[model samples]
Target: MSLLDLSWRNMKRNIRLYTIYFISMLVGVIIYFTFAGLMFNEDVVTAIQNKENYKTIIFVASMIVFLFIVFFILYANSFFMKQRKKEFGMYILYGMKERQVASMVFYETLFLSAISVTSGIFIGGLLSKFFGKILMNLMHYKDDISFAFPLEAVVSTILLFALLIGIITFQSYWNVRRMQIVELFHAKEKMDKPLQFSMPLAILSVLLIASSYYTITMGGTSNLWKDYFKESLLATTVALIVGTYLFFRQFSGWILQRMSRSKNYLLGNKMLWISSLRFSIRGNTVNFTFNSLISAVIIFGVGFIAVDYAVKADVVRKEYPNDMIFSSQDNRTQQQIEQILNDSHPILAHETITGIQTEKIANRKPFLDHPDYYTEEFTIFPEAQLNAIVDLRGVGEKVDVKGDEAIVLTRGIDQPKTYLSTLPTMTVFGDHTFQVVERIRFPLLSIPTDASGGSEHQPSVLVISDEAFEQLKGTRPITSYEVYKIEDPKTSNNVSRQIYDIVKRTEGSYYSAFIDMYSIDIESSSLILFSVAFFAAIALFALASVIYFKQLREATEEREHYAILRKMGVHDNVMKQIIWKQLLFVFLPPLLLGLLHSWFLLYYTVILIIKDLPALTTIIFSVMGLYVLTYMIFYVSSTSIYFKIINEKNTR
Candidate 1:
């Protein structure tokens, strides 16, 4: 028979072994093709405001997918080659030339590649429009996405995977050519040396991981982050990676060794599983460490994006309380705006807030860093006008200030005690001292703050009693803010644009439209969430597949050991229990560690950025729960497959 026929027959015979590898490659191709098609889709490109940036993001994401697929396919191929070494040795024993054997393997890989790529393209083409619809929905675009298969995308995916197939085929050829006959025959017998537990290394691993966590959490508040931000980040990353590696490398082995000596080791099936785990832990250390780190990253990345998308509306509302806001004292301009807004949408609340901008403000807190806080002017409003505006919007609580007391409104989400404590308790305005009694986090007006202008500092507004405001009003220049809350602000894009045009025509005018900012924020957050979610899914699939492949190989290697145990009267039920316990040991540790790592990372980082902590927590835990469920499914599937492998009747 020709090498092609032999290769095809061999693949058909070992199709089960190739299933996971084939699925992983197929998924990779589908993701690449779908994203490439979306990037080239005329509808998506033209609909998005920042077409170039959107294309760039999709291109980068597709490239990352390609690289990940390459790594996954190459690793699986190498594993398969290793598993088939004895077969090749037998072929050599039968006097088949090494070149011919290599050629057979090459043909097998080529056939698999062609099938996967063709199937992936067909499936990806069918799903591309569905993905486009989801993307457009996330962007809040009203237009429907029509299905169109871009030939360029198809050609690109074909070319990329063709190159990948060539590389993998060459690798198979090289591995086969490098194998000595004797070595190939003994390949399955090569096991890693037993690990010896080092007390110092175990302790060092704990210390390193703890130190890494400390650095990440405290780095933001310490001089290390302030003086050397990038270096600190690098150091933290290296420490965490090395610590995680050592954790699985040394600490896990040590624990398993200790368990092997424990009284519980005498329990039914415990000895069987624990002994096996202890023996194999050394070889599996790198895989365990890699799985742990990738799991953590996926959890953290997906959780953060999910929470960000969830709270996007809250964030937009907090930053912009009014639907339309612009500073205008011109009667003609105000009348024009009122006429346009009243024509289409009902004005929910219209307030002309009169305030004074004064640079004569003193008693600024020493802890505040913004030079603007100490030098720049502050907009001071009377308690009556502020209360009226708050009542009109129905957002923040009303303030009741007496003669000498003032309420401070700052730009940011409210943090209990943090903002109140940092703000000065007293302020001096043009020689009149007033006590600052209360602090509100969200800005009452939609005027731009220093933060909106790309500065780190937030703008402050002082609200005093009408008596105190009258006392200081004549000392500073007066400013009037025309703020309006219109009906259905989310759909007020046309009115918002017209307002923006009118406001921009007047110099020194400040304008903010809720719809304008909301649209941008929602679109960007949705896109990020969509992208990160897919990326996480791919990573997760790869992780699970790797673990699955490892366990399958182990099952094959341990089949003989099981057959011996069976002859010695070990029941199938007992063997099944043993397999379950063994798989649990392999799957649970990395998942628990990953969950813990992601929880800490999000609590310290995302909690500070998001206002609604309870909602954020819910989203995070929900994501973690879903991840755990996926792993559980993998664990169960692995266990069943493992039992099936070892329980098969011996052909020998």
Candidate 2:
């Protein structure tokens, strides 16, 4: 028979083994094709107004997808070559030249790659429009787009995969030509030396991982170690990576050796499983470590993306309780603001909030007890006006300041006692003294404007009785706040844009934290959320396939060991249990370690995103659930495949 016919027959005989690799390759290509199609979709570009940056983001993402697929294909191909070394060795023993063996492998690679890539692109074409719609929804684009075939995307995917296939085929040819006759037959028997754990090295690994985690989660609310942030983070990252490698290299084998010493635990069936795990884990340490690290990143990255969106949404809602807050200290008046709002659009519900604006005394001691408090003057509001606009009881007790007493309205800053303890009586503008009654919270106005038109170092506000406000003969500037709620909240973003444009035309430097926060929310939520999620999905699938294929490859090597156990009166059910236990040892370590990494990573994300532990915990759980679900799929499949391979010998 010709080499082509021989290669085809060999592939058919080992179709099951080839199917696993084919499916993995196809899934990766399909994902890549779908992402590329979305990137090149004309309708999607038009829906988002054809932003060059969006296109750049999608293009970069597609490149990453391509690189990931290439890595997967090459790695799987290398392992498949190793698995079939015995078969190839026999062809050599029968006088088949190395050149013919190379040709056979070249043909196999060509056939498999063609089938997977073509089928993958075909499937991707069918799903491209749906993928585009999902991207639109994720980016919050309101415009509806019609479906169109992405011819450019199809051509690009085909060319890229064709090139990838050529590279793999060339690589196969080179690898086969390098293999000697006897070495090929014994390639599968060449296991790495038994792993030995050094106590000092193991201790160093623990220290490094711990130090890295500490460095990552350092500088709590106040950013206490801000100066050390950058250098420490870089060092910690390097340490964590090296430490993780050392941990897997020595930790698993060391622990298994210790466990084997326990007579009761390591007796009989347990001994066989432990022996299998110990012998196999040394060779797989690097892979398991690498996979664990990637899995951790995927879990944390995807979870943090979702949590970031939720946190930004919450911040936007809290900061902008009203749709717009138009404040100006210049010749701009309440009437001008109202006219601008009315002339451009129909008048929606609006309210004008007025407050007394006074500069704080530069260095005045209000109360002698608190040294950390930097006392400052604040805009004072009368009880009637304060109650009209703000929730009094929600912050502090509603004050009935009978005489000269006044209450302070404040935000939830860290050191409340340092600020509140000295608030019973305070001096304003160097001469005016007022009795403090209570401290109310500022819900929407936590951050106060500074001289530079940003948040001040300290945030403070005062609330006094109406009688006190009217009786004040102090000469201080008074400011008015005009808050507006749009008729439709859905159009709030567009209205904000319009208002910003108007401000720009008038050369106004009106600063609204709410507007700035809202803009950031919209931009980041759209840009980062979907991209990270897509990569996370790809990482997850890659991880599952790698672990499944690795376990499946070992099935042949392990079959003989199981055969010996069967002759010694071990039932198939017991052997199955042993396989499950052995696989669990291989699988659970990486997953659990990855989860440990994810926990610390997610905690650090919470520090930036929400700062509320319980809320972030909920987000973490939801994200972890997605990862666990994906993992279980491969775990079940890998275990079943392992069982089937081992049992094949028993059918004889």
Residue 528 local lDDT, model 2: 75
Kindly report which residue stretches of model 1 are placed more than 4 angstroms away from their true locations once superposed: 42-47, 91-102, 126-148, 198-243, 262-267, 327-346, 354-384, 397-410, 413-481, 502-509, 606-612, 648-652
Q: Model 2, which residues run further than 4 Å from truth?
A: 92-100, 126-148, 197-227, 234-243, 317-322, 325-348, 352-482, 487-520, 604-614, 649-652
lDDT of each: 0.79, 0.70
lDDT value, candidate 1, whole model? 0.79
Task: Give TM-scores for every candidate, taking all chains together and pairing residue i with residue i.
Answer: 0.81, 0.75
Candidate 2 backbone clash number: 2
Candidate 1 structure quality by residue, lDDT tens digits, 1-652: 8898888788788777777667767887888888888888888787775566688788888898889889988988888888899999999999999889888887877777788888988888778889988988886776677777789999999999989988987898899888899999998787766788877888788888888888878737689899999998898888888988888888888888888889878978888998888788888888888999999999999998898788887778887777777787578878998999999878988888889776644535532334353334567899888888888788877778898877767655444233344435554554676666666665765544221222223445778899988988875678888888788786666677787778778776777767777766776787788789888877887898788889988998899899999999999899998998899989998888888788878878887656655677788889999999988998999999898888765642
TM-score of 2: 0.75
Give lDDT tens digits, candidate 2, residues 163-265.
Answer: 9878887877788888888898887676656566676777788788898888767644436456666676688778888888878776667777777778676
Error of 2 at 173 (Å): 1.9
Error of 1 at 196 (Å): 2.9
